[model samples]
Target: METLPIVPDAAVGAARHIDEYAAAGARYVTTGQQGAANTQRAYAGDWRRFTAWCREHGRESLPADVLTVAAFVTALAEAGKKVATIQRHCAALSKAHQLAGLPTPTDDRQLKTLLEGISREKGVRQKQAPAFTLAYFKRVLQGIDVERLDGVRDRALLLLGLAGAFRRDELASLDLAHLRFDEDGLVVELPRSKTNQKGEAEEKAVFFSPDRRSCPVRAVKDWLAVLEQHGRTSGPLFLSFHKGQRLSRRRLSTFSLNEIVQLRLGAPYTAHSLRASFVTIAKLNGADDAEVMNQTKHKTTDMIRRYTRLDNVRQHNAAQKLGL
Candidate 1:
């Protein structure tokens, strides 16, 4: 065997340092623990699109110059992307540069001005998800046969989602271990959520209604009984059935929750509509902002106010008290 030249100690040290640096950079760029899975996926797609666009234009994507970022935002605006989407794209680029240990060009005055201009040129108003009012919820419940396994699961899912003011992903994340039952109702412990990404568990209470037909607590108990019969005592709280008949061990996805809402209501309502409806109904029923926030887990009063648009107008109407 031919003897190879021995590597110098200094050179070896430098090589090891470089390897460590590269590993740290990789962790910074690829770690998915910072945000929700959906957010991480969206950011990844946005970054890929930005890099592809840069390659096509013969420009650098990582550590992109201020002018390049400004032009990219302008192009996105021209492409009819919503202002919020463009902003998210910008944020994705910023995060990429940050991970690479480069200063973000998005913070440049020129890029900031360009983004503001884009927002002004293309309206900043986002299309709100339609609220599934209590009345509409009752009508949907009337159609479901609570005696069946699927019906029991869906009733429980829908009622808990609305009464607990749960996001679709939060509802889907629930497991048998997360629930606690009592005479009053059930308390669900959310280990992680969109807002509570740090895994600091938050508990939401769902009270039993006087009427069994619309009671979330009773609905959940009925579903639990069905689940127990299937010998599923400790998996997902809500599961998907095979062929709409036999229960499967699979957990329901957030998309399925949205589809469930739309199919039940026979309308375009999304899963978020349940959360919005909870806030809206609470406010309309004279629950204060803090009270609404408690159930919705909203951190800001501004968000609560926005969700209660009709209630706000009614409560503060100048003409109503003026007897005009």
Candidate 2:
């Protein structure tokens, strides 16, 4: 019945002492490398929520019973949790059970049926981030004072995010080493993204605009000069600033990036708007799905279509052209 006595290696190995046996058991239970930092954090948080709920309701969280999981998810739905959120909670529960070497109750018919009912009732369509107009974005740029350090940095940040159609995390993770410049434009080396996790390197090109005031290439060059002055030629591309606007060496968090977007671009826009708007604006201006996908790095046209894919249904609706 002992954990140590059951393990195949610890059973026959000469290191049969309790200490060595315990060490061997510990090694097997070490952290899983199944996902990115964000995913791990999400799972950890979800597990905590599950454990807390169990404590309140007199149910077991780990090696959880099917009825209890079904009940918990039902409660989540009653409490108005999104279908996506409920599904993630189930995934977290499964992950926890798998790591602990237990048969996950999520696979049981009761839980499965409960989730399907929840999905059918709630519908699985995710709410997309609101995208703003390119004209509005340009007006925002005109208002910024590029002469100031923060202005210079923020302008570069917004432009690169738009032109590259970068995901929020990708935009935040940019490093000096990821960039290469030539006469025509800047080439950004994307080693990893949510879609491309194999670490296969991909390149995105941002060309110079004849309009100097709104050029992504020029804005980035200016921000790099600021970085050079601060002796930060490598590491995270964006940084947090001190109280007096003195630059802090610490890299900006994704939350801070969203705050920046909300602060400068108005409250309706989140960091996702940069990418969504890029897709929307490009498609509206006659870029085909393939052309939009090229900038967005989307593996398929479906996601591109979704962003065609709308703040207002009227703006990008296919019906606009029906002369009827």
Candidate 3:
């Protein structure tokens, strides 16, 4: 005769627990979406470099060993890579290992010490973007002929970028729909930024300048008028041009902003200089850290101090006040 088997009580509870946690387990696939796009891109590129290096050296990359990882970064250091770049490589390795369901060697104690040594040796002073003086800024604006499509767009971009203390991404991400102009001046509704990644409601004001030629508000208005002429009322504030200088619906990239800055200002300057220059100039003109932070949207005063490149020691030094 066939006998019926009895199931243990714990077996039913264990099966129920597995079913209860099924949603959480399924949600794990969305973990990659947690990081910003730029960060994800950097990690991906760094991982490719690391994997290629491993392949060249005949070392395994997926299940990377501590010694191999250490040696890889050492090679990068010997190759004169910056400390930040080397650290990013290690971070990329950690991500790669995590994706493969393995542990990262980057968390190894020896690797941390090596990274500290690299930081000390490399001198953790990152080169700041060169900012413009007010005189030069005015002169550059004066030289641009705003009658053309390219000229107007570039002028508006530069002026708004500087006055608004906007990052490159912020500038590139601008849309006409988010802008609000009042009697005081223009108020930009910033939807997303590096600090506010969840699309918070942050706004920045660009007041009218005493000098109409260099006014951020006026420049933006003129650009809008020109865009109206071209039937571009909404969408990207700064659009790219075609071969014949005809405007396209495509928005300018962050790199394009750098190119515009370098082409207009000089080689040493970049898109970041707009924001940096705002902090430096404002601080020199006696704007406190809080005042500057309000415009730059920086989370801390330390960043303000770092961005303020007041290199004129003779002008800024307290020795003059000491009666020396």
For TM-score, the strongest prediction is 1
By how many angstroms RMSD does model 3 differ from the true structure? Answer: 9.2
Query: How far is 163's C-alpha from truth in model 2 (Å)?
Result: 0.7
User: What ranking emerges by lDDT with the best candidate at the front?
Assistant: 3, 2, 1
Ranking of models by TM-score: 1, 3, 2
Give Cα-based local distance difference scores for all models. Answer: 0.79, 0.80, 0.80
Q: How many clashing pairs per prediction, in order?
A: 0, 2, 0
Those runs of model 3 whose alpha carbons end farther than 4 Å from true positions after fitting are: 1-36, 95-103, 320-324
Pairs that clash in candidate 3: none
- Give lDDT tens digits, candidate 1, residues 1-324: 121122243443244433443333334444633777787777777776776666566565545789888888888988999999999888777776676657889889878888888888888988887776688789899899876788888888889998999989999989999999998899999899878888896899999999898999999999999989989999899899998589999999998888988877766688888888888878767788988888888899999877764634555455775766
For 161-266, candidate 2 gives per-residue lDDT tens digits of: 9999988888888888999999999999998887777888798999999999889999999999999999998898899899877999888888999898888899
Q: What's the CA RMSD for each of the models?
A: 7.0, 6.2, 9.2
**Model 3, 134: alpha-carbon shift in Å?**
1.0
Candidate 2 clashing pairs, residues 3+ apart or interchain: 305-309, 306-309
lDDT, model 2, position 323: 89
- Candidate 3, 242-310: lDDT as tens digits: 998888889999888889989988899999999999998898788989999888888999999889888
TM-score of each predicted structure versus truth = 0.87, 0.83, 0.84
Stretches of candidate 2 above 4 Å error?
1-33, 99-103, 120-125, 309-324
